[model samples]
Target: MNTNDLKIFEAVAAHGSFTKAAEATFTVQSNVTARIKSLEEEFGVELFTRTSRKVALTTAGETLMQYCKKINHLIDEAKYDIKNAGQIIGQLKIGCIETTMALKAPEIINYFAENYPDVDLEFRSAMRSTLISEVLNFKLDAAFVSAPVSQPELDQIHIRDEQLVIVSSAQTAKISEVLNKQPVKIIVFDQGCIFRARLESWLSAKGIIKYKSIVLNSLEGIINFVEAGLGITILPAEVMEHYYAGRKLIAFPLNKELGTMTTVLIYRKDVPPSRALQVFADMHKVQG
Candidate 1:
């Protein structure tokens, strides 16, 4: 009936489990149950069905949930509109890819924090896929993700375009030479990585698929290995150009489609961000 109850209902619907919703909402399980009960009593319909292990929504619950989501989004928009009418102040949880941490994230965070000290900010580094899912589920206020991600449940704003380039040790002058070697040692992030996927696809298409690759879980590890002359790797030209020591690496462009990528700001399509987030987003919005 009220906003708090609606928030609880939204969280429960998102996670499909009361306990999980409670944890995400930073409340107790009893509180989540009570809010759901109140909503059910007011609407005269059950919103969830619980069995031994899992919980799901019935037809009535599904219908009510759709309306609940709309109502919740409307309330959020109204709040954002009012708060942006003046100085912004609140907490915002932001997500980013590990590659964006060094310069992009720190600059943005520092700029916002210094100007709006009253607003609290939290940062996280995650894979692009995970960041997208978290934003859609409302677990994150917004995120910086590798761009051109097409998802119906999210809104994306293109921030910057990044060109893909091959990075090799300072001692290695040519990539073709490495490819001809016995199982060319390559370092990369795992399967879920956009850069890694693109690199593999490009290599396969180019008839250069006989190389061995090491799959690292972190960007730092990948760069370190490449820096140590262990192998070669690929990354965003903008990011790599800014952070990497030029003396330790040489970067080359990929041919066409595999050559360029974009970084974007992403958030839930239907949910508006808080005032503090809006200010930051507005500042970073790409100019025409």
Candidate 2:
């Protein structure tokens, strides 16, 4: 199939709906359908299982998607090499954990944008696990994640260390008082969040195995709930201070073990970084 057809295929696979894919690719739904149909017919395989609501990739489609990612990545590299000629003038996709996005990313992003006016910058906020997975899958060029990442397929550069603390409402005199409160509600993000895991571990160590988990996706939501005395949460000290300024919340330092976490920028080791990605990484490296 031609590169244009594969590009449409990738968009459809990513969006999971031909109409949405068409909108993303600036084409009509009929053109997207025709391109996908042509590819399926050429391969003699049903690429996607169609449904009224949305489409799911078939086995053949999944295999094709992997190759499409590699092809797109290579094409991006070629464009950077030929057109930019070592200048930082390509799209840079970056991912970050929510806390980092809230506290640390703005200054770095602003600096990068000012310095590399030609680079198109895109950012996604996700948990550390999701960020790492996205970078490994080529969905992101790089990500800011909780450090101590041991994945051999990835290379990491230390960005900064975050001191974590147990945060509770101002009415609570001590962290123990908050823990001793009846029902012991813990405000947290969904599963696979590193800070949530650390909070759980600390709770379990204190013989608190039974507690109500109040799951909220946004950092503001969690902090607001905690400030309202609904539950307690663990967050970066800087994050709590930066947002709330310690006015409504009391921060309790954790023990040396769970008290600190490092934020590191990670990227896939196998892919040669584009000039944009390399320059971004170097900026952080110089800062560190």
Model 1 over residues 83-102: C-alpha lDDT tens digits?
A: 66676777788898778776
Worst 10-residue lDDT window for candidate 1 reads 279-288
Instruction: List ranges where model 1 is wrong by over 4 Å.
Output: 1-54, 58-85, 286-288
In model 2, the Cα lDDT at residue 276 comes to 81
Clashes of 1: 0
Off by over 4 Å in 2: 1-68
Worst 10 residues of 2 by lDDT: 83-92
TM-score of each: 0.77, 0.78
Q: For model 2, which pairs clash?
A: none
Q: Which residue pairs collide in model 1, if any?
A: none
